[model samples]
Target: MSEPAAEAAAPAADNKKKKWLMIGLIGGGVLLIVLSVVLAVVLSHGKSKKGQSKAHDTEQQAEEGDAEGGGEEHADAEEHGKKEEGHEKPKAEHGSAEPEHTTETHKPAEGGKPGDEAALKAEADQLKQDIAKLQHEMDQQTEMLTLSDEAAKLKSEINALKEKKASLEGDKQKLAEGVKQIRSGEKKCAISGNPDKRLDELRACLGMSQHGESKPGEHKPAGDSHEVHWSYNGENGPEFWAKLKPEWKVCAEGRTQSPINLVGKFGSGVPALSYEYKSSALTVVNNGHTIQANVAEGGGVVLDGKRYKLLQFHFHTPSEEQINGRANDMVAHLVHKSEDGKLLVIGVLLNRGKDNPVLKPVFDNMPGKASEEKAVPNAGFDANRLLPASRNYFHYDGSLTTPPCSEGVKWFVLKNVGNISPKQYDAYTQLYPYNARPVQAVNGRAIVEN
Candidate 1:
């Protein structure tokens, strides 16, 4: 019994054991398959890593080749620069032999690295701009210096011109003074061309009156030039005239002037006055000094048997002949000249009581304009009636009573003076009112009473 049961059970047990063995084997095979697949993936990854490392080596080789090629190109460029430099030297040598070099060593050149070339060109432009500014500044300074020099030169010229102008002004002032002196002398000559006046049978060609100052008849002196003219004013005035001019002795040396007094009583022993009328035409001249009427072409009067020419006639107020120690109203002097030019004077007194017809012609036509000539009426006039009927007189040697006081005048004053009205005295006083000279000393000269 136990054997059969044991055999069946063993088979069953063996089946069970077989079943466990199969499951274990299947799990081991799956594990083995997974391990093989993992091993195969690792092997494939190792091969891929080897291939990438080779590719990296190839890329490094290519970079090395490019570097070598760039170095060779740089060498070729350097070699070409040396060759060009050598050629330039030979060319420069040839060019220099001909006195010129087309290529220069230090010449400005182009074509370099762009950045470097541009930077150099900018530096050169900056230098050129700076040089131009410096040049402009220098030119301005030179122009300023030139202008300063020109201004200095102009100032010197202006100073010289001012000096010349001042010299010319001084010369002009001297010329004007000289001309003024010449004009003054011309005015004086125009006043000296008139004749003197007297009454009687005598006359003087050149006549002057006796004053305290200048000499009479100075112009009549012989050998005197025309410029030796007599002056009644200035240094040639009456009192000091002889000191200025030597020929004016009549003023300093002469003693007497006309208008004397007849003091003595009338007597029978009086000498008769001789008179002769012998002139034809007469010329009346109205000078600023006095009125004078001159007889033309030798008219004369005979006194003391001597024929004296009637030269001129003039007037004076208040008769020069003092009757009873007193002068009459007016008197006329008839100046006469002898054949030798000696002078004589006959004085006639006029009264104012009645209008005397004898003096009418002379008063009617008196020359009014200065330096003008007039014709006196040649009507009949009796020179004898001018004397007093008693014929009493006083004789003295005197001078003419004017600016140039001339001596050697023979004066005959009547003792008796006729009466003249106040109207007749006024008529003569209206013209030359103060013509009478003051009485002078007789100076021991004889005074005869007729």
Candidate 2:
């Protein structure tokens, strides 16, 4: 039993096993076919995945390469820009490849972008150059201003110095003039005392008394009247005055001329006549022609030890004293009275030059207008030089020489004459070139010459 059963069982089992194997095989085949299909799909999928991975890798690599290339391109562009900017030349960059865009934001290098940094540097350089130029201009302006101020200061200083020098020069000239005037005064004082010595001293001190030594040749009388008309430099001019004035007859008759040519005339052998003078009270009178200084009662004149009372002194132009018929420039008539009331006149001649010490006081005291009177204060006028040195004289009985000529005047004219300067002559001539009367016939008078 066992064998048959075992054999059947075994065969059934083998058949079952075979069937199971076939099922398994079929399943395995199906699984294999599915597996094969799945494998194929998987393989395909795997292959596709591998291909996608490879594609992804390739894409990543290409992205990396693009990134690297973009970086290099950017560097090249920057380099080209720098080169162009250095030369101040314009350049353009065009990217045909698509740009590698990045989300990350960045700033420019230090100051700005490449071009911007270049522009900023240029602007900084321009600012520096502008500042330097402006500073230089400001320095030039400051220097110019300083120079102008210095020039103005120097000019002002120079002007001030010039003014000071001018003032000092003026003062110096004034002082010199004052000293010269003092010297002239001393000389005049030394000459005033003695008649004989004074005459020679005066001749030595003064120049020629007359423009011409003698009066010009007399011309026939045209007419005579109070309103007589005369030409300045024609016939009957100032030169021939002796022919025109009766009171001026002594002009031709006198031995010595007034305004005497005194220089070199004095000699060591000549002795001066002695005389003295003192201050006296003075009264003043105004006439139509000039003012007169009247000697007061206390005043006296002593001549040769003869005492006389001084009356008055009057002025005249073209003085009565004459040298070879030449009249003096000006004269003063000093009237004196003897103890017996006899009248005596002393004549003093005057000429012009630098101001005369003796004449300045008299002229200063003179009344300006005709008929205007003024009293002299501290009267101190010298009368020693008033008379002619030569006592020898022409004696005649005549009238007053002025207007309303009175008769019965005892005229004693000394032969010697006095001197004056040419300026004084011009001054007197300016006042009255011809103020005297025509010469008269001597009327049987005794004429004398020294």
Candidate 2, residue 165: the lDDT equals 51
Alpha-carbon local distance difference test for all models? 0.50, 0.46
Best by lDDT: 1
lDDT (Cα, 0-100) at 386 in candidate 2: 49
lDDT of 1 by residue, 1-450 (tens): 599899889989999999997787667556654654564455334434333222111111111122433443221110111112123422111000112112112212234345557789999999999999999999999999999888876775564354344333433443354345446652122223344422110111122222211121221211112213333333333456456566555665766755555555434544456655543555555443345656554455565677776666666675555665777677777776676656677666666676655455455555554334456547444445444566555666676665356677666655455554565456546654655555555555566665
The C-alpha TM-scores of every prediction are 0.43, 0.35
> Residues 1-450, candidate 2, lDDT per residue (tens digit)?
688788888878788888986676456435533433443343333333222322111111122223433553331221110111134522222221332221211233343345656678899999999999999999999999999989976875664454445434433453455446558774343356777675444434432112112111111111111212232233444455446567555545543223222222222322122344455656454333444676544355565466666667766776654545666556676666667655555556555544455544455555433323455666666554345455544434454454223344444444455555565455444544555444444433433332
lDDT score for residue 418 of model 2: 59
